[model samples]
Target: MGTGWKLYYTNDEYIDERSGRCPSTDEFMYYKRLDLCFNLNSPMTINFPVIKTFCSHMSAELIRIDSSDKQQFIEFITANETIERICIQGTDKIFPPNWTFDDGTLMTFFNEDEASAEPDGGKGNIEMYTGYKWHDISDVTLHPCLPICEII
Candidate 1:
């Protein structure tokens, strides 16, 4: 049989893994091996600036794609869950044509979808919708997206 996984909120509250019910509060799923936390809730969408603010309140930042096995992580998240076009922390506003994470880390890893034309020199920040693809959307646009926050 396959291994079973348990879900927990940031506050250490337990959630029924099979139930697929998210905690009412801002919550994250803790990955023991990676020691990472990720949050993806539906029916709540916020813009880049607002997402940044929320992360700040939690003392976290939008998920960064700097891991060595980034593609695997992306695939895992996309295949197992139904996340709205959530916002990660990469923007090309500072250095034109160069995208960087919110923590000032250079974005050297990318997993754009094969069918998508990303970073089209568009306005606003970047978003992760449809699996591993990155799309440039307006900062003011209210999408059915969530902010994937990470402590580390």
Candidate 2:
């Protein structure tokens, strides 16, 4: 069997050979001061902002966060320097937590089959059809209508 790794943080002492659990703000500060981070373990339980801040500073590409914490994750990506990609998985949609940011670009990924065409009038201005009903691309396939703009 393969060994499991973990990132730990607690407010008290870290016992045994298991990953160190940060229990206090001071201990977390120590992690933040490190230049390089190496992980050899799973199931890291961190309950402090400092540790999370350190993880963000270490260029961790894959991070798992609580669905309810999506906004915080978004904030971290925008403010922190170490992260390159933030993937939100195990969900049915991209904006499930319903986070929004103005004056910044957000890339939303979807399956090719799930893509739908917009009306000619709505070209260059695409709004997600959350409140209104939308038909599939087939609805306009037979009409030879050229969209107002092309998205390349």
Candidate 3:
């Protein structure tokens, strides 16, 4: 027989059974400066389509770094999770080399090291490298990227 322990999802309408109040998860963190609640879930194989679906289920979306401030914030988020890479919101699938967010917004900011010839064309999805630079990665090896979500 299977173990009878209960489990909770990161997006669940969480309530502490003991205190009867919502409690933050070990992976939860929020910043009032940006008013963004972050979920630093452990790394897992991630792709845009599936991630989009999951975000909708949680009323969230993959993080988007559209400015220097946001780029720094994302860096902070990754540091807290100690992850090497995390999925972000951008894609060149529709227009190679020109990335856009899912909402059809033009991605005005970039943290990629242009000198490195980064964005080597990996399935058109964007990710944040440990160095805080942008890179296009394909989930070919089941890229173990973090699920960095921002609640709306």
Best by lDDT: 3
Question: What is the lDDT of every predicted structure here?
Answer: 0.64, 0.25, 0.68
For candidate 3, give the lDDT: 0.68
lDDT of 1 by residue, 11-93 (tens): 33322121233222466665544555666544346577877777767666777867656546655765655665767677787
lDDT score at residue 11, model 1, on the 0-100 scale: 36
**Best-performing candidate as measured by TM-score:** 3
**In the order shown, what is each candidate's alpha-carbon RMSD?**
7.6, 18.8, 9.4
> Model 2, 1-152: lDDT tens per residue?
34797766764322221234332222221123212112211222222222234344543312222233433323432342332222221121234232221212242432222344422222111221222212222111122211111000
Ranking by TM-score: 3, 1, 2
State, as a TM-score between 0 and 1, how close model 2 is to the true structure.
Answer: 0.18
Total clashing residue pairs per candidate?
0, 11, 0
Q: Which runs in model 1 stand beyond 4 Å of their true positions?
A: 1-26, 78-83
* lDDT (10s digit) by residue, model 3, range 1-152: 35997775653323221121212543445565565565656677766678766666656788777789778877765676756777888887766667888777788888885867676674777887748788887643466687677665
Query: In model 2, which regions exceed 4 Å deviation?
Result: 1-19, 22-61, 80-85, 89-152
Sort every candidate by lDDT, greatest first.
Answer: 3, 1, 2
